[model samples]
Target: MDIRKATIHDIAEKLKITASTVSRALNDNPRISDATKKKVQKVAKQLNYQPNHIASALRSGKSRLIGVVVPTANRNFFSSVIRGIEEIANSLDYKVIISQSYDDYDKEVQTVEALLNARVDGIIASVGKTTENVDHFKKILRKGIPLVLFDRVTNELDVSQVVIDDYYGGFQATEHLINEGCRRIVHFSNSQNINIYKERKRGYEDALIKHGIPVDPNLIVFSKLQLEDGRESMQQILDSKIPFDAVFSSSDYSIMGAMQVLKEKGFKLPEDVKLVGFGDEPFTSFTEPTLTSVNQKSIPMGNFTAETFFEILNHKDQSNNIPRKTILKPELIIRDSSINKEKPKDQTNLEVIEK
Candidate 1:
């Protein structure tokens, strides 16, 4: 037997009907009788005739694929979210094509355009730090594709969004520091433009205000989320006369960097400087002193995104009249790094000097 692409002509020849009738039967038009449709469908299946959806979508304007745009793919947080999205998408028989923005605006714009050219059915994205003007995303929306924003977002656009409450996480971390007797606390953040950082900064400020601590203008330092950036920021902070007893870094990698510098400078953890970080990446728990940080529920966020996109595709999204924002809470994991609680003395003394 020879394998060949099956077509509507095969169905017409088999059914002894005109090709037009076979086509209408295959489409299940009301004008076509049920018997004809059933017969045509059986023959089409046996012939393994697959319709070219691309051609159909060109005429009908729809696709079965979803596009995902994210910041650096190397990070644990984004990768975790992507895993969630991938799992759900795979289960639902949908394809998810992903691209990274690298936290750059122009790169983000280009990625969106390329995804559009691929004619994806919908998109889920976390805008980059430089994505202040969301007009590029807005253009994709104009083409009638549903856009969902996750993690970092732009307030200028009225699109569905899913993100963790970053401000609350910041507030929780900072307040924990003050409660533990840290007077001069500093915020070492990476990007200031994105919502995640902005909200976290606001929370940090609010915590300082509520706790009666004066917000030091010079304390909030900016640095890239890199080991070198962390080390350099620490050096600059140490060089200054302004002393900091505690640090709240927005990224775990930065927290580790600060820790390295603090260790080299001979500062004891929790005693000299209590530290906490955001985005509980894998290394957070294994580091020396075991970093205390915020768990952003990365995987759940991605899965929720995938699940939400499918709903939108199925026309079952929660709301249409008003754009809905699903904000998940970040859990604060208090580890040994920020542990100010004194450990109990070993009861070996009760042995009474055993021989």
Candidate 2:
């Protein structure tokens, strides 16, 4: 077996052509005839010649690669967003490298460093839950790399960001529960430092105030918004002896956890306690009583994120002038969990409320 790696020179030698001609033909340069280009490509494949993209990037100062960092790829929402990002990115001839931080600050920092070292042209990220200090992200802007953030974001960094109207989503969720004859609603949220959750909590509060319902401190539960966290929050609420008529969670996972606890405690959904969740996860519809949720428009979110990234990339010189902020509208999906009245099977309760 040949231990040495094949190069353009090897392909040229085998095809009896100049190395320059081989390179031009491999790159599909118009100066090279089609027949020659095809012949060169065939020989290059036969020789297993791999182009050195790193070397090419070093010379041209462009890797033609984009990096995306998400908290986790396990959720359907994140995966859908990734798909949307890829749809636009692949069409534009740029390859995307996805990195998961698992919502860990240290891991997010390391991933950003690794992407920078790889010489990616740009980076798109959703800030992790534990990322209090954004110096690591600041380093990217200092190095003149275009960074775009989506979903989970921070106002501390002046960069382009794409997010759904979280405040509206929260308000809608709470207002829907209110309309369902729920006065005492439990709001499950996460860190207030994160803009999305903060805005959501604000919306929740505002909706209560708008409806003449006193905002109860005990009704608002802040947690990591995981399934277990939801369980703990619900148990705490139950133990506190607060008579809540509805529950609105910022995450579907947490809401699902609350549902399980409610079932265990012999509380009927909608009849006893209405429920609404954010991020219309696929499993929401498959539950015993389908869950009502806010659709964050994952597909459109991804498309806008990629578009913003490219916009920054195109205007790299002016990227620092004024940061771009794109906010998309969210949809509320109504289902059995929040509806007290009997809904028809074929009825689609998708509401796109304008804010």
Name the best candidate (by lDDT): 2
* Residue-by-residue lDDT tens digits, candidate 2, 27-95: 789999999999988877777777887777887798889999999998999999999999999999999
- State model 2's lDDT: 0.89
Worst 10 residues of 2 by lDDT: 346-355
In terms of lDDT, the poorest run of 10 residues in model 1 is 346-355
Each prediction's TM-score versus the true structure: 0.80, 0.93
How well is each residue in 181-278 modelled by candidate 1, as lDDT tens digits? 88788898867777788788889999999989999979988977677888888888898968889889888888889999999879988778888989
Model 2 TM-score? 0.93
Q: RMSD to native for every prediction?
A: 8.9, 2.4
Backbone clashes in model 1, listed as residue pairs: none
